[model samples]
Target chain A: MSGASLAIPDRLRLLRGANNEGVLAVVLLALIVAMSIANPAFFTLPTAFSILRSSIVPLIFALGVLMVIISGGIDVSFAAIAVFAAYTTVRALQSGTPDLGLIGAFALALLIGASLGVINGFLIAKFRLPTLIVTLGTQGIFKGALLTYVGSRYIADLPASMAQVSTTNLFEVSTPTGSAYLHILVVPAVLLAIGLAWVLRSTMFGRSIYAIGGDVEAARRAGIRVMRTQVAVYVIAGTMAAAGGMIYVIMGRSASPQILVGSELDIIAAVVLGGASIFGGRGSVLGTTLGVILVQVIYNSLILAGVPSAWQRTAVGVLLIIGVGIQAVASRRSSRASVIDETYQKQEVPA
Target chain B: MKLADPETKPLSRLNDSVDAGWTRLLGLGRIEGGVRRMLILVVVAFAVFAALKPSIFLSGTNLRNIALNSPEIGVIAIAMMLAMLTGGIDLSLVAMANLSAITMSTMFTAVAAGDPALAEQLFPVILLAGIAVGVLGGVINGLLISGLGITPILATLGSMQIYNGIAVAWTGGKTLYGSPSALTAIGSSTVAGIPILFYVFVLVAVAIGVVVTRTPLGLRIQLQGANPTAARYSGIASRKILLSTYVLTGLLSGIAGVLFIARNPTASADYGASYVLLVIVIAVLGGTNPNGGFATVLGVVLATLTLQIVSSGFTAMRLSAYQYAIAQGLILVAAMAFEQVRWRRRRRSRKPAVQPG
Candidate 1:
């Protein structure tokens, strides 16, 4: 082959690696312009802030799920935990406990989330049960707990601080149509995302998760505390879910059984669409954030275009299929090429 | 391990020859044979239900109702068992059932609108549509999983959304109901004081059992599931086998869809959503290995009956539907947990290793 042609695969590999974030950044920009075209009202700071605000729960979920998925175990019950946390938070606020105030309630919920996660980790690591079955089992348990605690009763009339932080706006930003307000909640949410990204990219513990996902036995043999890492991953996942749950309760001003119904799938889809491997070993928090934004943009654009609510699931479902299909195809090609390269190298060796 | 004893083999062989021997008459040695534990659990469940609610559980009418109401779920569970036996899962089974049922219902509606008198004549069309929808879904699953080499669970998950979304979008979120009388009769009408669907499940179970035990295709499929590398090295086209397994699963799911719609007579978007877990539970309980390639069709059928009886018995005893749902979920968790413990115990008993190998 010619030198240029021989470099094609190398170029393709480089493009695959480096072009993911760039492509997503471009997609986000395009979506903003397209959404604005559909409704000039969509270009306002209020709409942007609202989208960012709406994104926080899923973003938190995505961050936690990223670590678990990278560590080679999935927590499908995170969504259920979110519902339970939100319900508990709302009830605590409603009951007006003096000892367990808002901060105490939040901390208590986080502890519950961590405990549940640890329980999940213990079951999987100790019993060696398949992650899918274990998670499915615990999902039922948590759902049962939520039902027992909430009893079909929703807690309303949140404390003023919680309500204000959830709904109040920062200074307005000018738009083509009109100036609009930005929410204060996005500030903390962004800070949380940034902090998570730092932990994932810079911490040794985070690196261990990636290593474990790559090869569990190898990591174990290399002196990594595999069980401890797994437990930590699940605990963080749970904590993030609880955080998201409380934020969701504050924003929605209510808690219901169906609050987070079937949301785990969406969170997973976001993670995968963001280029996180389902098989684990690799994922990026930055990419996950963009993935969340992409999903919101798609959702918001559909509404702005007045495509009708019934068609929304269908559209998103189609997008999921297409996105997964592309990933499948790309991975297949890379693996095939790698196999070929291995064979060629083997043949060249002194056998 | 005791069941696989070398000493018992000689006695077991002798008992097989002495057809009317005292040991055989006592049902003593048979407990050592295929899926005896499952059979015992099922028998105990039946006895308890019969004793607790004799008026409801053991009655012919109630039995028939239980059989009729659950056959579709049972049928799909059998399909799930087959896929699981091949060391893979078809998460799209529920979605496939939904799509197939919707297709059949939609087709029936189309035919009835053309000629109201031709309503009964469209039964075959509905059946064909159901099977066709299932096959198409299976093909997509097989192509992605086998051809493209995607992991079965993830691949089937993607297929689930695509299949279900199409069904919903095709119908515009509307339920297609009031199907032809003949179509509904498949579920509603009884033959010889038994629901037709029960017989259908029995035949399916027998057919699958025979195929798995007696046919090369079935043998190869299981082999591929049990040990893919070895099967491929032995000159078996493992991919083709995997593909066929998914297609068969899809076909059975389609049949289930037709039966499900007939029983309900209302094909909503949620037609098969709640059945996914129930199907898995029945399949796993029946003797299918959730991880891969080991199952008994007979075990699945029996487990389906036992579970259906328990749920129906609960309903008969004035328990609310939510209670039944909760009980079902708990039983499912218990069953899976029990299986996991059994598996770990067995593994622990095997040759111990110091490392991952």
Candidate 2:
């Protein structure tokens, strides 16, 4: 943010953009070093792969959350969207089209997820209602509808496509403790992250999202379709959440409606940790990826460090507060300049 | 859609603040249009359900059951309303309540040691300790938001995790029994077919009603939520008021904790996970604004009762528990959407969206 005023070179400005990632990487490294000194088992290849495997689910979910946050809205209903889309898709495939295969499964999941995303998008963009409230209501409705209309029972009998992915590990290593297997989904997750960074950095839709977050009226005045862009952002979030759910099912070889609905807070914490502003306007894929990994590490490693696993909740809360607090304070400190600009712009308007 | 907002006219907003301030100084609370609407909804719901199942829905046992379940959620809804009145919310209230209840429940076991005689004497002190836990938890949330400028939702979200963690860790993920017999008796006892616990909820609601409408703190909260900038310009200490608002929420949660343990034999971390949705629904249905600055206690109370009836009716009607979530979510969404309709109509007509009787 300070780079805006400085006579910094282009490369240096890019480095400034990576400041959040840099800090997170440092914290993560320090934590890893400390954990290694405390328990040698923590820094092993097996542990690394285990953490990586677990991260795929939250990372996908976090990417979508990162999108909504950048557009300056919150979606607490992603968990509901995830389970609702995934479980319904599984049930749909199992009932009739088991032959649709993996591609069909993903296509079906994305469609279902996107359709639901349309609800959030429509309500938010059309009514201009607060995103948090809309999502909270939908969270209940989606989860309830899933249990009421669809079956609440877990389905372990997955389609050949989903079950096959679970077994399609890139590599498995046998350690004294257990075998560590990296899932095939990790590559896609990385690809998605890179693709998202490109889109958010270079695409008009992505820049419009940032503009909307920064100032909706200003964006509208600048010929950015604010409402339409807001709707699209939520749609993207929904589709991503659905993809996350399918990935989760593919990894576990099961579709359980109840297992993933409560994990939104942790994912949100990770997203915020990665440098996305909760109030909106700015975020990065790299920062979010680091955040997801770091949060997952804290959640998984606390128990290894002799702290009770239950304190993972506390860790998430603390990380979220610290992460949000840093940005909030910095923004507040720099708000004076924006206040002057706002007045200057106001004077130009024909009110 | 954006142009429909009434907030565009600064001159009108100035009149609103000045008018509300004068009304508040006179100690006469402004009756928001939402309270009337919620009251109507409550009546309509009760009438519809009663007409549908006259024998079962209006039965003494069913009525008592509804009353029994109303207090815990009602108390939490009030906490949520106070936060909403400031355009903030306390998601951590439930976690804080659980922590408080667990604190008391475990302490009861420690002090009583299976002796009912000693349990009676130690109950009051132990209960105070539980409330103190909630108060302390609220203090942490207050300090985080009002002191450090964290957003209320994120701040409470964090506090919720921390509080829930402590409760879960302290309970070791197990349900602990042995609350004081006095609490159990109060929980189980009834007054004219209504649970004594329901009266406690009513008492809390009424007390809060007075505090919010009559007290200087209440006026400050209204002003702060209405416009933080205006409040600050008027010399109202925004931080202090925000701190007290959360603290009040905490106190309500603490009291709620006592009632929770009184009703149940045990306290655990995961109790009432569903209440999060129901509580928010009640607060919103009660006409509590999500943007802060407006709420009504009686409206929240009515909403709680209305939901309790809907829940009990669901059981009587042989519906699944999950359906209630849909009903609640639909109710909230419908209410918000209804607000939008009225707002648009009023904006289009350039007049208050008055409904004819």
Identify the leading candidate in terms of TM-score: 2
Model 2 lDDT per residue over A222-253, tens place: 99998889888888899999999999888888
Where does candidate 2 stray beyond 4 Å?
Answer: A1-19, A172-180, A332-351, B1-31, B114-116, B351-357
Question: For every model in order, what is the number of clashing pairs?
Answer: 1, 2
Per-residue lDDT for A1-351 in model 1, tens only? 444775776766554454265556677788899888878878777677768877878888888888888887776878877777767766666665554555776787787788878877887776666666667667766776667545667566676656666667767777665667676666767887898878877888978898998899999999999888887888788888888887788778766766785767768877877777777887788778888888888888888888766565556556666666766787789889999999999999977
Q: What DockQ does every candidate get?
A: 0.38, 0.57
Please give me the DockQ of candidate 2 compared with the native complex.
0.57
**Residue range B166-229, candidate 1, lDDT tens digits:** 7777878888786768767677878888888888878888888888878999899788778888
lDDT of 2 by residue, B155-190 (tens): 898888888888888888999988888889999998
The C-alpha TM-scores of every prediction are 0.87, 0.90
Candidate 2's error at B61, in angstroms? 1.2
Pick the DockQ winner.
2
Q: What C-alpha lDDT, on a 0 to 100 scale, does residue B46 get in candidate 1? A: 76
